[model samples]
Target chain A: MTDAVERIVNLALHLAHAAKPVGHESIRRDVFGYPKDQDEAAYLRMFERDKDELRAAGFVIEANEAGLYSLDSAATFVSDVGLSATEIAAVRAAGTAALSDPSFPFAPELRLALAKLASRFEPLEVPAASRQADESPSDQAENAAALELATRASKRVEFVYTNSIGRTAAHTVEPYGLFLRDGRWYMVGRDIAHDEPRVYTVARMADLMVSGARPKSPDFSRPAGFDVSAFIRLPFQYGDQEFSAALRFDQSAAWRAKGLASGLGVLRSEGDETVWSVPARDDAALLRWVVENGPGISVDAPTELADRLVSTMRKAATLHG
Target chain B: MAKTPASERARRLLAVIARLESGSEIPLVDLAAELDASPTELASDLETLSLCGVAPFTPDEMIDVFVVDGMVEVYSPLPALDRPVRLSMTEARALAAALQGAGFSADDSLVQRLEAATAREFDAAQAERIVRAASGQHAKGVYGSLAAAAGAHRVVTIDYESAGGAGTSREIEPHVLFAERGAWYVAAHCRLAGAERTFRVDRIRSAQENGESFTVDAADAAPRTATPSGDLPTARVRFDAAGDFSARDWPGARLVSEHPAESGDGDIAGPKAVLGPLEIEIPYAGTDWIARRVVARGGAVEVLSPPDVRAAVVAVAESYSG
Candidate 1:
């Protein structure tokens, strides 16, 4: 491992410093720690490994059949993120808020990256604001790391995943991006088996491995104009269809209900109860909310939903009985 | 998993070079410590520096490395190496999502800063989609003040409405303000209850910061202990496979056991166990909280014990008519 790292470092420097594209013969002669003379196989293996590592690190090391290597001119390090002092503070504060959530997997990398960026400016006071919500804990460190790696490398990943329905299966996907929605991390990618795009909840995944065993070779390319959000279809979409559902929250749970309904649908107050009308598409979601809030909330409209709720309640009552 | 020394060293070497290119003379020890390396590794890095530079490889063109006494001076003057690197699109996207998740609107100052700081042209639509809140985005002023109070450790009187629709005034020493499921909450010491509490910030009607300050101990502010007093009364329930994920959302909820799938009943009228059963224990302040939940979920869950909880659930379920 040490030798591999050292070779990559040396090769990167050699390519970076070259006035012109450095040929393989020149690299072998000038760069130290190359295979001792007459071991062509070992030298080629080491060279390929170094090239891959450097490319993965964001160095655009170009090579051809003739073994000429050059760093992409535009790929050199630049000092200007163009952030003002206030911008740095904002980024720092955002980072701090993210770190406060114990389940965030990328905290270490975030801290190191932010420190480097902030070192350019005088330390700024982190704006005191509310920390981010700690959602239900999800142990997804390995998945998170794998997604990060594949996303950066533009490579594919293979993983064994279990869906909510309890079906576990293996899949290979070309990762487009990773996103967070509703406090959950999701990976948007193209499923190889299905030959179409899919969104995966990171928490539901297990045994993730990034593809592209060889360096500088990507397993797949993201489709043109691929939108991560466009491909994602959440299983439950309230009020997305023809069902217009109205729920009434009595005074007892009105305040908390309003908080829950903050920006979702039209809410109005009538006497002590708050009446909300939403296009109820999923029964389970609303049911969960109503059940959690106790008797203070009721489905007043869409008799079908109300009937379902009552029947569901009756089923639950039998369990306790 | 632990990072391999090779990968760790590669990361540090890249970071060190990038830092030095910012025209800063970094102290050898400070740089080494930041990289989690020893002075010996720093020397090795300097030795490696001798081999790097752009074309012609002349002394002047190469990165000059000097460790005089304790300071490491590096001069490359490489245009490629001089500037602060742009935020990678992934990093920018993640930051944007987190900032938005914390309830910052597109017009918030921090959001504006983020837009300004991002040097590359990010897809505005993509970024918007990533950060858009599904619901319960906070009112900016209320969120900001509470956050400030918590950071400053100020005791403040707040008019808060409880889940049961009761409003009360209490002096709370704000320790931490966080969001959970799009709702903002402040974990604090409530003087009225004389116990630690987590108050939903949005439900707080008004806040009057007291000039007085207080100290916060880590033990006192532990999140598990921050449950508001009213959510009392511990109850245990078993949820079939389909409901296991959501059941864990309850405060202080834990999985106690898992039961094999129960076969169907001979009678079609009776409830069928849809999925394998999972037994979970939860500490809840209100029986109504559990009762309503079980009633709503229908045959999916069952309150295993605590006759009072069972009765309450049965009552609520019987009250609802289709």
Candidate 2:
């Protein structure tokens, strides 16, 4: 492993720093330390293993049929997140805070990412803000790792997903990107079955298997211009069954309620009370939010949702009171 | 720092090479410190780079390096290697996500510059769609002022809407600004509360930098990996398998054990005998937060200790029909 590792590192560095792509003969003659000649079969096996290891190490090694290899050094090394000094400090602080939250699946990765950026910039002296301190860390390690591998390899993945409805089913997806939203991790990918972009919450996924795990990795590549943001949905934007729901907030909570309604739905203020007609993709979550705000918020439209909230509240009142 | 990953180290070395080739004769010690690597490891990396070059193996064609008295000089043998490293797709996405989440808008020139530098085209519209400013335009302006104050270590008076829905004015020493779950918050030392507090930025109605400055204790300023505040009351709860999913990310919460809830103990208010398999303990300052969560989970979880928490849950649940 050490020999393979060292040779591959030198080989990659050579290619990365080389004036041009080095052919197979030049790599064997220059990169390989042993001066003595070797059998072609053994050399091929070693070279193959070296290539795999390099790829696993996150190097994009491009090759031609003629065996000319070049390192995709540009893409392999830097990220153009383009954060300013202050923004970088903010990110580092957040990364530190995330590291504090033990449940964050990407803590180590986040640190390394931040460190890489820190190398180019100064480290922030003070801590920023921390989050997920009061939240449960998801038990989605397997799924998270699988999605990471798939994204790194630019390969498809197969997994068993237990959707919100609790129906566990198998899915094959072309992993595009991994995103953190609302304290949860989600994979934005193309669902091969649906032939459309889909967002799969990592916590809901199980038995994740990267397509690259197979011996003959597919020649599959992500579509050009694939953006993870397209698949990410906000809290209120989640759920397929979207409908208009209205809520009225009394003067007491009008300020916050008005803020929530901005850029989301129709809003009107009457004297002191504020009314909002919002597009709700998840009625239960929407209703729960209203109920949690207590007496100030009242459901006005979607009588069914209002009824459910009222009944749920009534049941709680009956049981707890 | 954890044991340095070889790949990451290699990339850093490459970055050093690029930086060196940019005609800056940086001292080896400073370079090592900048890359967060030991001087020895960096020296070794230089040794490795010395052996690598273009196809032909010749001294002149190889990367040349001179390390003398802890200073370093480098000359790249390969002209093609002089270009600055571009950000990888994943790296770009990670930064874009984090920065946008931190409130950098698509229209922000820095963000646009990053987009231009990205190895792959990241659609600004799509990126904006993923995470938008949680607060409105007015609140966003307020957030900017508060964040600036925090960065400058200034004391600011803010008209804030408290969690209980009351509006009040407070003077706080701005420490740090952070975003979580789409909401922006500033953790600061509140002169009014006489304690360090986390204030939601959106809830801040107005903010004015008093031009008064306050120095944060170094200990308090350092990035905290754990909750910075002092200890609080602890609550114990049992969660069913289904409940575990939702309970996992609960803040200040830890899974105490995975043992099934045993039958009734000597205590009159004991386990219901049919409790779930997972038991979690969370330290909290108050009951309102945990109570709301328990109510949300319905019957999947139950508070096992602190009668106050159970009572709080009951009170909140009862308010629905009140």
Candidate 3:
């Protein structure tokens, strides 16, 4: 119903007339997933519409009684053109998480939204946001059921929450939105208990069922002086705790950190190393940040944190040695 | 019950439409009888045909004309009809989704093959349009082709579906065939194995040479025969009250009673919440299924049924612990 239809049609016409006796059945099955006999009506209709559409679209579909419906290239609805089913899958796959879907709509959703904006797609070719790939068949079915439930009720959820790392926790949340980022999946919502907006990793969720409680989103006034732009760019979330610590990054790493700023850190430069006064509460998260920054960055303050960094570096060195 | 050549009739009628549009006219009685359509049906087809065109609004639409004095004598080349064979964006989306689900895509060479095959039936733009909107989960590659071969009594070579991906390729006499999740699979007698084996067509690496054919035994093609020993054990898990906190996480798991007499309140009322030391089983094959199921349950579900399966889940959980 969106832009994907138009683009795929163009692609299909190109495929149909690409070779001698174009194999339309392959299109129906590979592209359309319909059985050969089931698409008979389609074949009939093709005769009625081929010329005008083909010529206009530049596919040059001819009709012959050989090949699939025709062998003669001239008689087929499509003339010489190129590509295969797998290649098209690869192409169309980029837009939808269903192609590379892992779990949850975390970052993949952002990427899909950004990608869509970048492409300037024909509204008709706008494909459905793909589902995260790697879901077992039954999981897909469950997701479908969940989506349907969401569409029908327009409410929040109480689900056994599974973290991206496969840790399980239970949360009662108002389902606000669903998105896919990279290959990961996430569902954004207001945690009903906490009454704050939170995102749940979908693949981690076990007993997921959409709640029936319908709560209308209130009139939104952006929180006064809230930094929306900074929030959007920032990746990691700071929990209840905040840390004021200093980091010394080498010039090369500092330049990359300042320019990219993919995630956290209150970045500032001092001397040779850029002194980043980063805010991360606990040991687990702080450790993660340090590891990601690589060997160049060193924890200057908080001897415990610095020790952790040194120990981590020592482990890396041992491995390499 | 015969197929009664319904498809053939549908094919014939479409041909007549194509011929008429291409400026060929046929006698009414002859066309009607050939199509097995009654006089009224033929008249209806003609009436529908009368309305068919790019639309008389544009001079090009009015360019084609036909006169029915006594019988039906159609005339002139009608440009492609506006109401010609076309699919909606929704339909196309379903198709694409289905194909994608089945592991087919438009960029592959098959897309071109599909175009050529359906060319006689569909115009380039229309076909392309339909395919672009298409979405389905069906593997129409080697699997579908093999199934077709099996139906034709053709012996084909294919890898057997076993543990480590695909097995060695062997010549097989494919008999019974079925489709699972839009992919073709055939249960056939493998010459080497001398036993009936189910083969996934997509796993086949080479072209299926239509070897010396044989007859298919119709009686053996029943949908699901009872197994020799139907010992399909459902996977079960048991966890204490600590586990019950995360009970809702496991999909398809029904929390049974730790206490039969006492009732639960709210959603947990009437044994909705399985008490600690609970038992749950998920029916499936292989340890992978158990691992996935157990992992999904997280801290809530503990394995109780099928001791080996429980052990497998514990092992999988331990792997994650590291």
Q: Over the stretch A115-179, how does candidate 2's per-residue lDDT look in tens digits?
A: 44544655344356545323345465445655766675667788889886679999999877766
Residues A208-295, model 1: lDDT tens digits: 8787587477777766666454533332353456566688987765665655663456898999888988665677776767655444
Give one digit per residue, the lDDT tens place, for model 1 in B159-187: 87654435789999877655554455677
- Per-residue lDDT tens digits of candidate 2, residues B1-322? 5766666665565444545552345678876755557888877777766665554557666667766678777654443344444544444544554455555556655567655445444555564543332222235346556655666677899988654445789999877665555566777789998987777665687888788988766665654322222476778887766564333245545556644443433221211223346776766643665676676555556788888888777777666656
The best-first sequence of candidates by TM-score reads: 2, 1, 3
DockQ of each: 0.23, 0.24, 0.04
What global local distance difference test value does model 1 have? 0.61
Scored by CA lDDT, what does every candidate get? 0.61, 0.61, 0.42
Model 1 iRMS (Å) reads 8.0
Which 10-residue span in candidate 3 chain B carries the lowest summed lDDT?
B82-91
